[model samples]
Target: MQRYFVPKEQFDESGVRITGEDARHIRRVMRMNVADTIICANNKGDAFLCKIKAFEDQSVIAGIESVLTSESELPVRITIAQGIPKGDKFDTIVQKGTECGAAAFIPFHSERTVSVWQKEKSEKKRLRLQRIAKEASEQTHRLLIPEVEPLMTLDQLLIFSERFTCKAVAYEETAKAGVQSGLPSLLRNMKAGNSLIMVIGPEGGLSPNEAERLKQSGFLLCGLGPRILRTETAALYLLSCASYHFELLQREVDR
Candidate 1:
């Protein structure tokens, strides 16, 4: 069944009311009708199998049939803090990162960042990214949508990331020096349910001074791998490694 994320307030004891874009998509785009079954996930990450009860006044009311259970989320919460890159790359980052099980995203202004969010259109861009995150979450059957934060300066990102259990910067220099233990060692030290914030540089990568500042703020300057990866791919790589260590490896241990 197709899935849609409904606002927490829209969900009641019996069912949920889907409104706005989702309702339009259900009624007009998907052409779904009454009695059609769909999966509805609330903001709190609870999902239910629902049957459409009615389409009224730009809304689709669905009655809860049963609770739906799935273990699709990452055990560790990973947030991607990316230096602003050019064009539609950020969109790809948010969409793919959500699919890879990222819990949040932060677009930051690094010293070497070439693209800046213009003041007049910044909110529009942020909303677009938020929407992308939501759509990606629903498509991946993720109960909670990844949060796309407002564009932040380097200082703000550091402060915002303070709540995470661990923070790391994807420094290419470590990768070039044939250092391989950085990322793996960090993973081995991490426990399930920990939150991680990964800072990735934009196209030209972070300046040495910026990287050093992050290190001073207790962020690990870890290399991703032997080869360099584009800014867009770095977060996905980290998330995949985490899934391997925390999910895939643990599955074997359990078996």
Candidate 2:
């Protein structure tokens, strides 16, 4: 069934009320009508199998058939702290990262970051990314949409990361130095439900001084592998490894 994310307030004992573009998409694009079933998620980690009940004044009301209980999220909450890359690269990151089970994203201004955000346009750009994350979450059947947090400076990012259970920075220099144990070692210590923040630098990567500051702030410095990756690719790669360790390997361990 097609999935739509509705605000928690839109849900009630009877049904979910969906409005705006989603209502139009249901009535026009999907050609859905009363009695047709679809999946509705209340971004608070609850989902329902709903049957279309009524369409009124630009809204589609779907009666809840049953609650959905399957899980699609990663075992650990992973937040991608990306140094704001140039162009539309961040869009690709949010979309693919949501599919890969990232829980949230934080775009940061690093010493090597090239793109500068216009003060007036920053909110607009963030809203756009938020929309992309929502659509991607629904498409992937994610229990909740990954949040696209406000853009922050490197200092602000490090401070914000203080609350996470684990923190790491992906430094290409470490890869070049042939240090491969950091990430795996970190994952070995990770437990289910812990939150992790993985920082990936922009185009030129984090400056040596910036990497040092991160390490001083308790962020582990890790390498993706021997080959260096573009700023955008590093987050996806980290998420892939996390899924492999927490989801794939955990199943084998369980068996």
Instruction: Give residue 39's lDDT in candidate 1 (0 to 100).
Output: 96
For residues 63-83, write the lDDT of model 2, one tens digit per residue. Answer: 999999966888899999999
Per-residue error for 234 in candidate 2, Å, reads 0.4
Quote the lDDT for 221 in model 1. 91
Candidate 2 off by > 4 Å: none
Candidate 1 to native Cα RMSD, angstroms: 1.1
Off by over 4 Å in 1: none
Give candidate 2's error at residue 127 in angstroms. Answer: 0.6
lDDT of each: 0.90, 0.91
